[model samples]
Target: MNRKKSLQIFIQSPDLHQIRHESVTGDQTLADLKRSLFPESNHRSSFYFTLHGKPLPDDTPLSIPQIAPLSTLVLQSRLRGGGGDGGATGAESRDCYLKMYSEKKPDKVDPNEQRLSKWQNCALSNEPLREPCVIDKLGNIFNKEALVEALLGKKLPKEFGYIKGLKDMITIRLSSVPRAEDGAKFQCPISGLELNGKYRFFALRNCGHVLSAKALKEVRSSSCLVCHEDYGEEDKVVINGNEDEVAALRERMEMEKTRVREGKKNKKVKGESLEGSRLSGTKHVMAAVEKASAKVEVNGKVSNGGGAAKRFKAIDVAPAHATKEVYASIFTSSRKSDFKETYSCRSLPLGRN
Candidate 1:
């Protein structure tokens, strides 16, 4: 018996449209379903399908050899005629509002303002405020606590406030942070970046706001005066260490390295003949301790970044083996069998017929 390949596809869209269709044959194209999904529209090439919520070409081949079973299919249509071959320049013809303005004013007073005017009424009243700050060069010290506290009062989420500069005003400086005795995790308030150690700094992205650790301490609140959000020490997610703990760890590592280097130079001279001595012993001990402790530290990290979604649970079978029998067995059997049992047996005497 020849196996028939099939697929189960799920369709999703930004306009809140969702559909699920079982592909009975591998030869089926998305264009076939587009008709059922859209009856009145002859412009089949205009709308695009989003598989798993990501835009994909409609003519893309779904199945090979047209023989497979146990597949999942999702059919999604573009919202009210959006994606098309005309591209951005031709988009104006589709929107009546854009066409009206384009005809009314072939030229505008301010090009920037003209674009913004077209997008009127799209602004959100509850939009968040942003601040600017810059990082200094290395070896610079800043009061992170005070800076975060002041920024928190501005009603902006801690993640939005980041380092920025004017004419190279934004300088980044590295400083040590206190660590918890056991271990702890920290997240940068400005960038929402997570780090294992108590202290670390890096350049910020996608933000025009900038402030340094030192200047942030002097400020009482975020520059956005209307925002009155306040942050407390307790609001921070504390780990095993404070800034001091991190400082000590850094110092220890530094001292060990310095001693080892000195010992190596001394041994190279005619005065010291010993290769594996006190310095080597100390280095070995410290390395072992650091490794053991790090192994046990909490691995905290953000799961979602860059708007990527979690991976879908997938079967272990190969794409070619996913045929129609396999697809139906996975989903449709339960629904079909349930319906047959109830409907085929009759509707148990309706009250009024």
Candidate 2:
């Protein structure tokens, strides 16, 4: 067995229940850790690790790597790669030059000349010019896919992977389709590809795609993905009549979902509702038995707490030949709503309702 060292495995899932132990051995590789964390579940590959805020690829080489020690590992799925290798279209080249020269040029450099210098570097990349990994105004990493999606309002990939990171927030791919101006076509903000409703959403591990509505339904009643609170309902307000109608339908479905959730909740409320019902029927069989045996109350008699004392009753059971019949009688009537008052009196044999 590996030395018993304490290691903290931080999963990206916002669900507290989802995070768990790896195996009995506990000491595991980055790869083994990922696998053990989700044995039967899908989506195991897309996870990458970061130690102390520096992103590390899953395949990172570790020599005498620290294992089984709590060093703070966070699961992430951010895109991998750096910026610019020449090869830029005229528009991109101009933008890059202007951005570099006007905003970032050193004090000694002329902005126009700096723009020209920056443009030359982009012209060298042979690959059909890709977007430079620029930082957005918000300081967020700007890749081609995200920029495209932002420029066009819509999702990038109809089918894309998502993961919940350490802070209890979800991270989704930047490849969704953007809402096009024409209202008919959806283009990817990143790849600039056309998107359709048929696309599916998948796990970060590329498990598969799911429908947006279906996904929303599944997650609607859980803790808030952003705030991680008891509030799980969609908070957005409908802005138009058509939207209001759709919202009403969604609300109806949500009410049904809430009902089903409530049913499960009731099932787990207490044993009194279930076992107590059965015990009431069992009293019938015991009634006759008590009649045959002498009643004994050592100290105090059983009472219904109503200031009055009631005598205990018992059931009479026949010999082996009739035992099956007795059992059938008890089982069948056990589930009846009025089993206690109706068939409970031996003198009265009330049949099915």
Candidate 3:
């Protein structure tokens, strides 16, 4: 056999703190690279290789242009389940082999164009479906957490206008799954870790997409990742959620309700105050008109000093209809103050009578 040409490479752990140098044949596959780097460990399947923040395909040859001499590569381990003995538990070991072996990027599929079934991987995160998973009215299945975060204001490339709030969505329980055994190895699309109580999961009330609590905490916006649905404060619900989180969600919902109720109450009070002021202003105007009318009647009797004046006053003031007409004329007049000024000047001349 001909001598194999070897390439020098630098390898580092996921944290980038542990670095090592190794020599390997140009034709060696990624699996072979992992074995060489982690010779003492039997759980090599838990680790994956990455180059420049992107995962490397296991089938990719070391001689590829991207793998230059002394090039640095990241060897990351999937976040494992906790153990009772302070080491990886038996479940962790069993789930290690289930880790994604390929280097394909998550969210490679377009959610708008593709219609994924409930049993298939998520179109956005590429993780297996789990409890609290929901199929939207459009027949698309997604994790609740992803939907909640998307609704909570996380920016997404696509637009989902059909979803409005959690009340419109339906929740899926563990018993409803057609094949419960198939989802035992479900992992988070973002963290690539097995879903468990420690990591926790959340679902969106609107789209019913599930996501890990850790992933939701990192969300800065209200848009869902899979469907791009925007979620409001009331649209998030815990899927097999922690007690602390559940209580907090309830408290937040109550607070929001109280705030909305108080806002409406304050608005009603302001409206009533405005109506009361209008009524008081109308009464003031009526009082001013009545005072002016009484003065007009007294002037007519005093200035004339005859039975004819008394008769004219009785015709003008005794009938309510005639008095109302006089009031209307004074108020509708272009110069409202002119009537008051005219009455004041006439009253001074009437003093002699």
Whole-model Cα lDDT per candidate?
0.38, 0.38, 0.58
**lDDT tens readout by residue for model 1, 1-353:** 11234343433333544333333445556666676667888877767654323344666555633312322233333445545776565333434543354368532233333222222111111111112223222111123332344444554333333322232123222222246232222334443333332233323222312223323344545341123344442111212234674455446546755898898887687344454476788898987765544432122333442233443222322255576456546755322442323545643334533
TM-score of each: 0.19, 0.19, 0.29
Q: 1 or 3: which has the higher lDDT?
A: 3
**Per-residue lDDT for 295-328 in model 2, tens only?**
4452354324233334432222334556555554
RMSD of candidate 2 to the truth, in angstroms, is 27.0
Off by over 4 Å in 1: 1-3, 16-18, 52-54, 64-353
Per-residue lDDT of model 3, residues 1-353, tens digit only: 11255555667663554466677777788988877767899998888877755767777788787886556677767556665677755544433432333234221232221222223444333345655566443334467776776667754326345555675346743323334463334555555544433456656676656666677778656886557889975676664434676567557656866898999999999999999999999999987765555432453354433323233323244345466555555544422342234634633234454
lDDT assessment of candidate 3: 0.58
Q: Give the number of the best model, judged by TM-score.
A: 3
* Model 3, C-alpha of 3: deviation from truth (Å): 76
lDDT, candidate 1, at 242? 44
User: Which TM-score value belongs to model 3?
Assistant: 0.29
Lowest summed lDDT across 10 adjacent residues in model 3 is found at: 109-118
